[model samples]
Target: MSAPDARPVRGKRPKSGDPVVDRALALLAAFTEEHRALGLVELSRRAGIPRSTASRLAARLQAWGALERDEHGRYVIGLRLFEVASLAPRSHGLREAALPYLEDLHEITRQHVLLAVLDQGAALLVERLSTLGAVQVAYRVGGRLPLHDTGVGLVLLAFADAAVRAQALSELDSPAAATLRRRLADVRRTGVAVFARRRPAAVSSVAVAVRDGAGRVVAAVSVVVPVDAARPQAYEQVVRATALAVSRALGARPARAE
Candidate 1:
């Protein structure tokens, strides 16, 4: 018979020597956009570990500076985690190269400007800027959006390596999968993607791919505006220009005239 303290682990065991690593990670995952801080009991419940185990893991994390105590005495993700996360090449590197252009787009348009990259089969928002009256969007920094439903997603899909594209296609329902293939071809031909989003009520986005030194598409830049205010296509040139500028900053040279 199992002892009263035993609790089943939530995820796959880590191959590393520290068997508690996965549990520690699960504790970290317990905090999210909605639940930014938690008490020991709540953290344990959410992480699917015993309270005793949660306390021990939290102690270790707090000691290592991966977690911190809030003024309210709840546990929160720590500065040390941010220090580590800031080094992620896909987000930090691209954001460093894209911020000036993204800020410019926001200042010029006074709208929602975003930068995204393909990550784990989704469009991961790396940065976003919005003006006082800018249209609201569903995405936030660190959030993921569907590659099939967003303008940045289309750009990424159009240029994604065959394996990533194939994996995405295989995950969708047959009809939508077939439709995406057609859209990808159009995006490739035009070098831009424009799409209307129904959420936040009738917003449209225009986006273009940003390439790296080897001319490999590494990220996308986009702007969101009201559908009735202006056609999304109207922003295509500026978005393309911004994306191109960022690509150049990353050491990408323009393609030779055909």
Candidate 2:
């Protein structure tokens, strides 16, 4: 719910910045959605603090086990943070109900399948199943992805609250953002996202929304196949069927046929 890093100060010199609080959080912020590991110098550079300041703060963090010094002398976020992050309530609940369907879909498709939820203005891939035949997708479980870039990401942003939706759009480029707005409207109307290659070497991704018992789109399910084998109609049918099956499993009844 809160931004990863905030300007909250504990003890401080008033106006400009607090050396203590900023450096502490800066050590933590040194780990990003991408690089979860960093050397002291790299961490210092990423956090915009001096190496000596980073070393001092990092020592305390290591003492508390919030970070650990690795074999190469680089530091990584510790297991304690991961242990705490794993206790997030929404993540615990979503997987319990949606997992069986996710497994079934993965088994059926034999491709890269994903289940993701909207979190903090980005879509987080909470679960993923990759088959041998599947194309190599950039997505990883627990990774944060841009909402306008991936199939599941689009659906989650499409039905998100207005402020979150606005934040998602702001993260996009102007032309791509405009394209996404129109694409989202279509996803809402059609209830599916068929994301195929717009250029060479892109994977074909097809996705659909999954509703909970309350009929809200709590998560999105998607499949990625090789673009060379892309058949929009075929992928669309399989994705819709799997989504409907999953929805019913979650106790969501389909709207009557139009």
Candidate 3:
């Protein structure tokens, strides 16, 4: 028998002194929207770990309630992970303050309502609401959107720090760079962003900034509608109203009318 404090020495541990914590995290990261449930073989392949190592690590994760097995014996992400992730102050606090306004907008438009924040040089979608027959969009909660695309991404980029703006601009070609600069200038002047895309489906997004108590643009609220359903401009005013409402809920003062 081992001492109470002694770590388990069972199984053939990796001989290279690999970081077990990172390997464990990799196992968790292997699960995605398209691959929510995975057998041990697929999980090992996706995580790039040896089958035996994966089995050992998976057992530990299961014991900690970070993973669960479905009736089919495939591993699934556990509720304990969500319970922990829900405590992240940024996403949790912002979602709490924005959900009611988001729901109101959703009910009014019956379209996709998005709330996203700047994270890791991209717009991280924190919340989304959609109806049964709403237009399908590629974005999902917890997904990162490009800063140079999407209405919320553009709004966040427009209000981002100068250094971040430069980094994003530097990645574009000369002509595209010039066009984006002009667009960013317009977004800053109007405090709103309108972006349209044709691929997957023709849709337009109208987005406006959400501010925090300190008057900083902390998030963006947007409504996505099919091009044929309504002109993107038609929803601009309502989207702006929703954004302002969410901002007020976050302790931001209302902007004085021009």
Error of 1 at 178 (Å): 1.7
lDDT (Cα, 0-100) at 117 in candidate 1: 93
Q: Which of the numbered candidates is closest to the native, going by highest lDDT?
A: 3
Model 3 misplacement above 4 A: 1-18
Q: Candidates' lDDT values, in order?
A: 0.88, 0.78, 0.90
Candidate 2 lDDT, tens digit per residue, 1-258? 122333445674446656587779877987876787798778888888767767888899888888997888889988877677677755746666777877877787777888888888788988888986576777788788778878888888888888887877787789977988899889888888877765445687888888877888888888888877747447777777777777787788978651
Listed per candidate, the RMSD to the true structure in angstroms reads 3.6, 5.8, 5.3
lDDT of 1 by residue, 1-258 (tens): 122455545675456647588889999999988999999888988998878878888999999999999999999999999999999888987898889988888888888998999988999999999776766677899998889889999899889989989998999999989998999998998889898878867888899999999989999999988998777888988898899889999999967430
Model 1 CA RMSD to the hidden true structure, in angstroms: 3.6
Candidate 1's C-alpha runs over 4 A off are 1-4, 7-16, 256-258
RMSD of 3: 5.3
Clashes of each: 0, 0, 0
Report the error of model 2 at residue 126, Å. Answer: 1.7
**Residue 100 deviation, candidate 2, in Å?**
2.6
Superposition TM-score, candidate 3 onto the true structure = 0.88
Root-mean-square deviation of Cα positions for candidate 2 versus the true structure, in angstroms: 5.8
